[model samples]
Target: MITKKQIDNNTLSDEEIVKRIVNGESYLYEHLMRKFNLRLFRISMSIINDEMEADDVMQTAYINAYMQLSNFQHKSSFSTWLTRILINESLLHKKRKLKQTQLLAAQTDNEYSNDNPLRRLMNKELKVILEKAVSTLPEKYRLVFVMREIEEMSVNETMEILNLGESNVKVRLNRAKEMLRSELSIYYKTNEVFEFNLIRCDRVVNFVMNKINKES
Candidate 1:
């Protein structure tokens, strides 16, 4: 895996990298791929809930991106532009796999997903319980929540990725938060308290950001 130090040492800025890619210095594009793969995977996974499919979505998005590279207008951050493509790819996969009954089944089963060992020590046994609750959210709400809350993307960036307007994003985010809070309330017995440790998740955030940056 490429390290941040390696990324920082790379010679080209994003625009420069794009120019190089467009000029047929195709190998430089691999550097971008390495940068953004993780972040894109996370987004794709949040939508599809299938690891292999998420990987496929990321790969397909890149292929589509490379073919359309000449059309990139620099209107949005390169990261946002690439992410939007992946988001669409993931959603398309969801649509193809869509079944009303299966969606309901996944929602009902969301409460029993895996627990990260570290999370147990950080919070109560109920940490994964809350996560499961979030998992049960409708796909639309779930995607927005994960992008904004877990990925910590800015509203504008999210709007670009989700192809939503500012007001729509806000509305969905608010509803998602409300649903999460309500579910957590029940999971915690309405008495057990838990504090989120931002510091612990910093590495995850950095990892995702670097993946996107490199994959770009």
Candidate 2:
């Protein structure tokens, strides 16, 4: 039973934690999953454009990464490697979803309801608007924007994760900002976008923990 105090000591890096898990202290993997759940969720959501599907994509990615943990050579940072797996999973899911939608449309021609942000306005109206604006961005730009601007990852780190050169990363980021600037002038001060609420965070953590425990 890994306690919060053990994880809170914060002395061990991600690499060291992986080593511990590989050495059979499997419970510690929950700490790593919790650490990156929100970032991965945001990443999945940015690509998939559907929250529930994004959640499922993240869960599958985590399970796949854990199963392949031994193959995680020190070629890149653990987060980068995990992110790559997540991106692959999300893209694959997206491809499958597109195919399904095409086939379903051919059969039934059912229409889907547009998610109108105006109807969801509340106290945090600006935040909701900002999230919608970010989500509406073209996929190429949205992922870069979220990784660089929202997650605050460094240029080098973003480049490593996305397999893009610094210039490409900067260019995409600039374009994303330009698009958002036009839409968010009055509401650009707040940085929160696609916030992973605490309840969802705990849910993801518990789901992953339970799955890992059962497998072990």
Per-prediction TM-score = 0.43, 0.49
For model 2, the stretches where C-alpha displacement exceeds 4 angstroms are 4-9, 109-216
Name the 10 consecutive residues with the lowest summed lDDT in model 1. 111-120
TM-score between model 1 and native: 0.43
lDDT of 1: 0.83
Worst 10 residues of 2 by lDDT: 109-118
The sequence of per-residue lDDT tens digits that candidate 2 reaches over residues 121-211 is 4535767888988987899999999998889999999999899999999999999999998877655445656667797799899999999
Q: Across residues 1-216, which tens digit of lDDT does each residue of candidate 1 receive?
A: 445654542666776788768997676678889889889988899999999878888899999999988889988878898999999988988887787668877875553334454544555655667679989899999999999989999999999999999999999999999988887766455344554458658987999999999999
**Candidate maximizing lDDT:** 2
Error of 1 at 86 (Å): 0.3
Give the TM-score (vs. native) of candidate 2.
0.49
Clashes of 1: 10
